[model samples]
Target: MADATVRPESRWYGPLAATPRHLFVPRWWSPGERDGTWVYELRDGASDPDAWMSCAYDKSLSVITRVGPHHADHAASAAVVPEAWPTSSATLPALVVKLYQHAFLADDSRLLVTCGSGYGTALACRRLGDGRVTSVDVDPYLIQSARDRLAAAGHRPQLEICDVTGALPGVYDRIVSTVSVQGIPASWLAALAPGGRMVTALSGTGLLIVADKTADGGATGQVAPEPAAFMGTRHGDDYPPAPDHADLWATARKADGESVTTGRYPVMRVNSTWDVRSTLELTVPGIEHRMESGADGTRTAYMLHPDGSWARATAPGARQVPTVHQGGPRRLWDELDRIRTWLVIDGDLPVAGAAVRIDPDGTCHLSRSGWSASIGAQ
Candidate 1:
């Protein structure tokens, strides 16, 4: 929150200093897990100035604006919403800066940026001038509100309400997205000016892909070493309700599956580790992960796929191996173990800095060290 010492001393600094993030997000949601229930706590800047300043200026924390269909600005002061997934937010400042830095923006660069809370767009406008920045979002309200806020901050950039994956508002020298996509949209390739670059994270994983537009309307680049997570782009007011996997949840929590094996390692919350998790995600996308621990020092982990594949693993403690149960078409835990074994043998996963070749049709092929994987259009 207090980073006075770390300064890049570029055009961004003056804009970052001039633009107040709090103005764009007067009220936002801060998430917390309590009693196994996911809760969104609304924080009002007017009521709690100290808390607002602490979080608003913090360089690493994202302030959620919309959770599901609920927007914090519309919520009652001090309201807490239970079991809501953040749909929109003002992304962490440092990560925004990271995306911009990866873009390698020149002073004269024309940028097409995504508008969430519009804080990032404001920063871009500050750096490249309002005339060179075009900001778009799927939510019409977000676009209008952000336009007003940017004007209040003494800047006005082109703002439009448009789905990011469909068609961009304009051709640009840089296309930076805070939203995640399963694969680079074909429309993006057509819209990007030649020699322009794009920076975005792949959906369901923390892989930050940096690619430059190629002569063939495709792109080729390497995955960044660092990890970043962003909400997937949404077309509707809310993401579809997650599948009701009551039977699968019960089986994963208590029932034994077709086969049981002693795991080679302890219960691992694989989703917590970016490298392994990203590799597993790259190998098998759209798998949901969950983990819980018992009072008796027992740990349990579950993996569920929309295809009805499920796996459960339990361990006694950190030192003891887990007993795994897998069912459905795929042995989910076994696949995870196979990936881990590969990592053990190679000392690293290919997902780290893998070569990314995105086709004109939106299929992405990632390869490294003789390993290969692909993400089809979502």
Candidate 2:
């Protein structure tokens, strides 16, 4: 995992190699389908040592530690939790390194990072010493478990049970979050030392922001050239149930829209494409997407927003244009087509390398090529 995650001479190499990731994650959840319904199948490392080593060291795989409110360690033998969001995980090593790399840590830089299974915090401790690293998580269980595990691994960093968006424990020169946030939290601005850097991804988008604290108690940076995403931070056991979209789904699936037209682009799985998804998320905030492909070569895509807007588009095949139907106060499909058109003409979306200016109040302003969007406190 170390070799796959970082170069031998990289500053993170020694720390990554020295830390035992498997210790941080003794039990994890794996997704599987049971009787046609999604479920999280528990996997105990002690029960299967070989599989444990393989999975724990896999550079690209994130070991889910807690699913909704069901923690794998406390689950019954061969437990399977009904499908729900993952609450915590030992994030993929490569991605963790990427977040660290974005921070540009100095030799003595005080580091504050989001802790889940504590693997990332261990790596930070190994690299910068336990005294220089502080990790926070909202789950009290996670904090206690991680603290015990870190001590067993011969490292003890300050582990706090606190929401990342709330008051932080101390000022730090480098702040990095494995969990995504909707916007730069004002508390983060207040906790960062002058000229400190922050690296985090926006929730629901693949845009990573790397900002340096400014004199005005805000931040200035840019959307990373490469896209990355992480689960959003939660204050409680699980995220508030995803917005109820049952009625909107029905409207998108069955209702003929107020306007119908042949779409200029093929039906796109907007949720799957990072660049396109990021751009649309910036422009149309709370939209949800669903897609299906018929066995007979027909593809259909649906878009629904909390504002009572819905769009359905159907195409004969992957490369064919789609017939679009949109209903509501706004034309959802047209907005998607417009963004696709911009991509076709510009060869890239503006969100990729957009300039990010965050206000002291946590209002994030993103702009590039005359396109600008603001994400304020929710």
Candidate 3:
């Protein structure tokens, strides 16, 4: 290990500087290894500390420690090498601190946290003592690996092999989820001691929820100022194939009987940002968007969901007329059009601090900036 650039003299700088990132992320992967059966490799930085320090401090990169629910141990040795999409990582230290700050962890508070690489759990132990943290993960491999890592470092945090999105085992003053959730699990609320706070991200968006547990088997909260990313909840190692592509193409690019429109917003990049994606997901509900570019010059974007809702747009050139087709009781394009209209009139649909209400059955209600919607069971 080498000297770190994350400053120790600064307030949050202590953990960044003190924690050894190189240990957390000894290896990573890239796109080329998508087909390879084996991935992962060891870092050769014992000979070059400066190179290691640079990677340790990079805010944009996450140290990949686990993949496809397979931790580094059971995963192939060289398979951890830089190749396919990084399935899981020890999120950068600064982001972890920010999430902890959002959680408002106090010395007296016991926390139930989701474990991935054990980096976050270590930080919580450093902040609130090892006994005050309970970490859970769905994969036994992850929990076991994290436990070994913590034990080797002389830290004994509570580690459990449990599904984070389902029933959590312990009660705590606060719950901080480093994983995104599809819904606010009722079990989490049940595990929270009365008035406990939870800081978590909504699956598929950059939305950070800050809610306090209520007595009536429900919770209420608004959005947070900072945006964070966490691996989405998983039932199995990988997510089931999102609605079949053939079915998407079938309803999305229909032959006849639909209205068309020249969209007002010309080809906005709705793919990257969380705010835009979350808004679209809320307004458009179940529709899934697809973007394509032809070999020649045509480009198309399609939205298809299980509700028989479909919307498609074809553009020959940027800023040109985009032929659109739509179907379903809730015209998906019209909803996008409404969002665009709201953007034009008010500049943006309020996302953060959008009122969230959860019932005993785990249904979520999202309302903000005058648009209200509900999400039922998956």
TM-scores, one per candidate: 0.96, 0.98, 0.84
Prediction 2 global C-alpha lDDT? 0.92
Residue 217 local lDDT, model 1? 86
Output the lDDT of residue 165, model 2. Answer: 94
In angstroms, the error of model 2 at 33 is 1.9
List lDDT for all candidates, in order. Answer: 0.87, 0.92, 0.71
Candidate 1 or 2, higher TM-score?
2
TM-score, candidate 3, is: 0.84
Model with the higher lDDT, candidate 1 or 3: 1
Clashing pairs in 1: 1-58
- Candidate 3 versus truth, CA RMSD in Å, comes to 3.9
Task: Give the Å shift of residue 341 in candidate 2.
Answer: 1.0
Q: By descending lDDT, how would the candidates be arranged?
A: 2, 1, 3
Write candidate 3's Cα lDDT for 1-378 as tens digits: 112333555444655545555665544433233364544554434445776667656765667665554445454444444433345677766677777877787779989988878877877877778889999887776777778778765579889988777778888899998888877888877888888888888776778888887789777887787767687877667555556668657767764426777776665556566767778776565566778777777777777777776778788866665787776665676677677777678866687568877765667787876777776532
* Regions of model 1 farther than 4 Å from truth: 1-5, 33-36
Tens digits of per-residue lDDT for model 1, 240-346? 88888888888777767787898877888887888889888877777889998889999988999878789988899877889999888888999899988988999
